[model samples]
Target: MKSTKLIYMILPYTRRELPGWGKLFENLGGYKSELWKDAPIRTIRGKFHQYLMTLDLSSWHERMTYFLGRYYELDIQKFMIEAVKPGDSFIDVGANLGMITLMAARCVTPTGTVHSFEPNPLVFKRLQANVSNNELQQVTLHNCGLAEGESELTLTVVNEELGMGTFTKIPQQDESLISNQYQLTVYRGDDILPEELPGITFIKIDVEGFEPLVIRGLDRTIQRLHPVILTEVVPEHLERGGFSVKELCEIMQNYGYQPLNISTKRSGLRHHLQLTKLTDNQMTENVLWLHPENNLSSRLEKYFKES
Candidate 1:
């Protein structure tokens, strides 16, 4: 009964998606999956996308979307929409439930293609469903992950968050935190991708702590295509993949790329989450690597003006 009033706030946002949450009145003392949540919901954050998300309200990725129209990285969406275009092959190395995949699919249309890779069987099902429901024929889903080379790795998923699965095992004091383990197939970027997919326009790779290996696997492919790469770059996460932040940047810089400070966090009550740049010292998580030779300035000139 504590959230009686709060239920009203969630009701307006989640009414139809909830299949009638007014049933909350029926069971004031308890909460059940059947009473409020249902299978396959139209995500508020997606473009009317039908997603088979978990009923767990504690998951930030799933929960935040209930309150705000969009959660997750706002800048990532902004960058993808602006950078991607029709008739361009966009690659998502670690597509979880096809958020960016769906965005790229709409951006590319049927003329182009989207190659999305998600190795987790549970998460792949959700990602596959989103693509199928939207009839995104241009998207070719791959139930695998990118690594340094062709091999099988044990993926660990915890706390029912499918997006959090990773090949790099986390050292934990309590093993009970590990909810599940899956043997997943992985490969090098150049080996798996068809030669026909030349000149990839953009790639967004976020494979938890295995980002460095994924980047290494794409060494040849990136050198050849020089696509704009949006990647997660946590220092500790890179260490898990046997790399430092400096080493990762060196690898990218060797391929003629430089990082750009795209967006930063701002105070909530005082201001909206406006599109702004973060100082180099502040940018520690995600980095957008631009290729000077191949990247079209026109694509981002509207958002980023030259000094």
Candidate 2:
């Protein structure tokens, strides 16, 4: 068991050192055969680290393997590892398969707790399995979604792309693509109050296009805790969800949150954090929202400056 763990940890580094080694490995007859063969679940070590993921070679899984290269959003993963402190409370809204949740749990170990919320039953089961297999004691999994209110919403699950599930109302023209629609109960962050969420320092939200609604529901939490937020800023998704990207930025600005572009440069793990104006054309996959009052901004600035 110890040897297997060591191999998993070292495999990522080995791939990094060899450059294109992952592609070469994937092209091998033996590795290609495993991908084609029928398998319900196959545990694979991450490309950048020892993180384990149980995949079924579905669209989402294949996408992760090819595009993400197993690490899954390397920049965001690094930011979480560096930004989150021990004992700090982290929230993973739209936790998906527990990738960020698992990473955060490792960063804020011993005393910290990671709250992961995933509404999709099929994806939620996989998330639960990954968290359990890794034995992440710091993670607390929730089976519901988070929104602006405590109402049941229709979740459109795309069979081909499970990760693209959205609670937002879909347009009539695109309704034919929905594989299934399930009723999911969503609760506001304020609804949980100080008891359920105590001193939340960091939050990562990626709910397809429901980002604004989720932020709307967490207004109270943001006003009080002023947690550092890492969220997706996809304009099309936001528009489909009945909210504009401009509105989302305005809401964050109203709450004293400043938008910054956190990108990983070509030179190693260096992060370029720049105060950015949220424009429609400037839409990126992820952006960091920082509160001026919190010392986190200064800390992150210092880290980047030093690095």
Best by TM-score: 2
Q: What TM-score does prediction 1 earn?
A: 0.79
TM-score against native, each model: 0.79, 0.81
> Residue-wise lDDT of candidate 2 within 191-268, one digit each (tens)?
763445434488899998999999999888888788899899988888889988889888888898877766654445
Q: Please write out the lDDT profile of model 1 over residues 67-125, one tens digit for every residue.
A: 33443466777666666778888899889877778778877778888899999998899
Give the CA lDDT, 0 to 100, for residue 6 in model 1.
51
Badly placed stretches (over 4 Å) of model 1 are 1-58, 198-200, 264-282, 305-307
Q: What Cα-based lDDT does every candidate model obtain?
A: 0.69, 0.72
